[model samples]
Target: MTSIWDPIRIGRMALAHRFAMAPMTRSRAQADGAPGPLAAEYYAQRAGFGLIITEGVQPSDDGQGYLNTPGIYTEAHVAGWRRVTDAVHARGGHLFMQLMHAGRMAHPDNTPHHRQPVAPSAIAPGQTMFTAAGLQEIPEPRALSTDEVEATVRDFVHAARQAIAAGADGVEIHAANGYLIQQFFASNANRRTDRYGGPIENRMRFAIEVARAVSEAIGPERTGLRISPGSTLGGIDEGPEGPALYRRLVPALAELDLAYLHVAQGGNEALLGEIRRLWPNALLVARGGRPLERAAADVEAGLADVAPVARWALANPDFVERYRRGAPLNEADPATFYGGGAHGYTDYPTFGRALVAA
Candidate 1:
């Protein structure tokens, strides 16, 4: 039986342990969508994890939706991230850039250009996103013409190339959590009659194209994708057809021979196991709602190769080591989750140091 602290082979990269740091968005970047000094130290401190998937980074200015979030399409952004990647590599960790495009989930006040969010269709998420001022209703997004959708795919490719240039081990396409790709996945948000909407195959078109383009831009060995099947966040609902969509998507993704498939499972063990069966040979990292013990069990049962934790990782930088020794975990401050200073970011002490103090 393998333990959570044991070494694991995840695609082309070898992780020292099976514990990965799940990507948690901290609106700590500059207003211009560039990563700041604090962002570098925050990621560096948590480099003990087998892998670090970064916060949703915009592929272009139009892709940005939240205030003070980072981007990857600019020279300055690449330079800024280079510092972060260098720090993580110096500490013996692998980092993957997560490219996200917030589609109908955008609020005008949250973006730099204040551009209307774009999606596969003209539908809106009917939810509000945080802005500099306060919570504002998400405006109806412009439908991406087929040409524009192709352009968006190219943009992701370019961002993936840029991330590799910035010293990242790989890139993970953020196709989850009601972003651009998920917008297409959800029938409620994508009512288009085009080839990019309607049936499951058409609805999965954008995501598949984006994944193929990114895999081609960089080697497939350096590409990964995150998906949340049947998640209804941001008022997205695909109804009964949701499961069928992923049943097709996972096998198709597996055929691409990409690095890994990080599935954010929200209490659907049967579906998760089904996906595991479909994605036969790839490194499947299962996340979402699994306790640490269950996560370890999932790996031992061959349900997944790694288990990612979000909140616990935020509070405990030395998560792998702490879990290995069964040390008490630091409680995460929910109030400080989004936009805050070093208080809840990099201020958590390791168990060894905490024990010494006691």
Candidate 2:
């Protein structure tokens, strides 16, 4: 049985432990899309996890979906992230920058160019989001032409290169959580007749192409892909073929011999097990609505190589040490969960450190 403390190797990065600090959105980046000033401190504090996947970073200006999220396709962005990656590496932690695009789940006021959000089809997520002016309804997005779709793939490739230039150990393609790549997986959001639409193979095309391109740009050993099949977030519905889609998609992505496959499981044990079997490389699984203690269940069961934790790791920077010593964990405050400063961002104390009011 694989214990949570067991060492694991994912891609070319050898981790000292079997858990990953799950990628989370902090909503604290600069208006120009550079990472926040305390990003280095924020990430380094959680470096004990060995594998720290950073927040969802936009691959382009058009990929911004919320206020103050970070981007990775610019010199300033690379400079900002270099500080972060350097801090993590200093503490013996490997960081994988997650490349995310919001698609139609965006508001014009939230982006740099202030242009309409783009998706595979001209559909809105029917959701409201926080912008500079406050909450606003997400308007209908413009459908991407086949030519524009190809350009988006290059955007991901460029971002991957930028991540490497910034000293990241690798990059994770965010094809989950109702983002642009997940939008393409959604039947409701993606209604185009292009090669990237219609059948499951077509819907899976953009994601695979982006992965292949990113792997080509930055070696496959330095690239990983994340997917959440049957996701309903941001009003996505993968339709009835969702299960079958992963059954085929996982194996297809495996042929690229990518670093690892991170699956965001929605309590679907059967599907997750099938993905574990299909993927030949390291398999990192993130379980929703589960405690950090429960996060190791998949790893112990031989169904996952590593279990990624989100909220617990966010609240307790020294999560691994606490688990090792059986220390009481701190609870996270919902008030400072988003768009906040170091109060909740980096003030979370390690086990015996002085408690700060959140």
Candidate 3:
């Protein structure tokens, strides 16, 4: 029986446990798109997890979607992240920065430049996003030209290199959650006739190109990707071809021999099974809002090599310790989840510390 406490290898990085900390947008970055001052403490506190996947970090200025989310394209951004990476490494933990491009989900008011959001097409997601003022409607996005699309690939490559330079163990391309890459994958979100759109292969071209460029820039051993199959978030409609699209995409990613493929399970058991079968390398599955025992069962049954825990990891910094001792967990407060100070960020006490205080 392979318990979640057992060690595992994902690419060149060896994890101390099978529990990985999934990326969650905390909106705690500086106003200039740099990581907040307490970012290091926040991640370091959760170092008990086998791997720490940082929140969605924009690859370029136009990638900004929500206010105070971090960016990885600037010197200041690199400096800000260095503090985080150093803190995690000192605690003997591995960290992967998730490179995310917001695409059509972005609001101009949320970004520093107030520039129009870009997507695969001009269609809007028909959703609201949090801005400086408050929640506002998502406006129609400008479609990227062929040349611009190629340029965006380079932007992801640049961000991957920056993450490595800042002392990160690796980078995970954020292809999930109806973001830029998922926008290209969804049929309704992408209705172009160019080589980068149309058929499943064409729709997958942008994601493959971005992956290839990032893998080439920073060795494949230091790269990973996160994908959400059949998700309807951000108004994405992959239509009836959703499963078929992933069947093609997963194998293509496996051919690159990248670090790992993280699947955010969205109630598609058949597609999830096929993804696990097609992927020859390490596969990580995330079952949102599920108990830790379910994650253990998945790994024990060989359904997944690793399992990512989100909410529990957020509220319990000493999640591994709590699970080990069967200790009570602190409930996560939704009110303080985003754009907060240390009160909700780094103030989560460890099991031993909490007991002492009690």
Q: Estimate each model's TM-score.
A: 0.96, 0.98, 0.98
Angstrom error at residue 103, model 2: 0.6
Writing each residue's lDDT as its tens digit, candidate 1 over 1-358 gives: 7666678776678887777888889888876667877877888888988699999899998898788889999888899899999999999889999998988878878888878888878877788778878888889999999889889999999899999998989999999888889989888888888899888999998889989989988988899999988778878786888889999999888878888888887666788889988886545565656676675777777778887878888998987788878888998888888886888787888888778888
Model 3 TM-score, all chains together = 0.98
Per-residue lDDT, model 3, residue 48, is: 83
After the best TM-score superposition of candidate 3, give how far the Cα of residue 278 lies from its true spot, in angstroms. Answer: 0.5
The clash numbers for all candidates, in the given order, read 0, 0, 0
Which residue pairs clash in candidate 1?
A: none
Q: Order the candidates by TM-score, highest first — what do you get?
A: 3, 2, 1
Question: For model 3, how many clashes?
Answer: 0
Worst 10 residues of 2 by lDDT: 349-358
Instruction: Select the stronger candidate by TM-score from 1 and 2.
Output: 2
Residue 334 in model 3: lDDT: 85
Model 3 Cα lDDT, one tens digit per residue, 1-358: 8777788989888887888999999999998888999999999998889699999999998998988899999999999999999999999888999999999999999888899999999999999988878889999999999999999999999999999999999999999999999999998999998998999999999999999999999999999999999889899988999999999999999889999999999998988888889999888998887865675788887888898888888899998889888899888888889997998788878888888999
Give the Cα lDDT of each candidate: 0.85, 0.91, 0.92
In the range 239-265, model 2's lDDT, one tens digit per residue, is 888899899899899999999999998
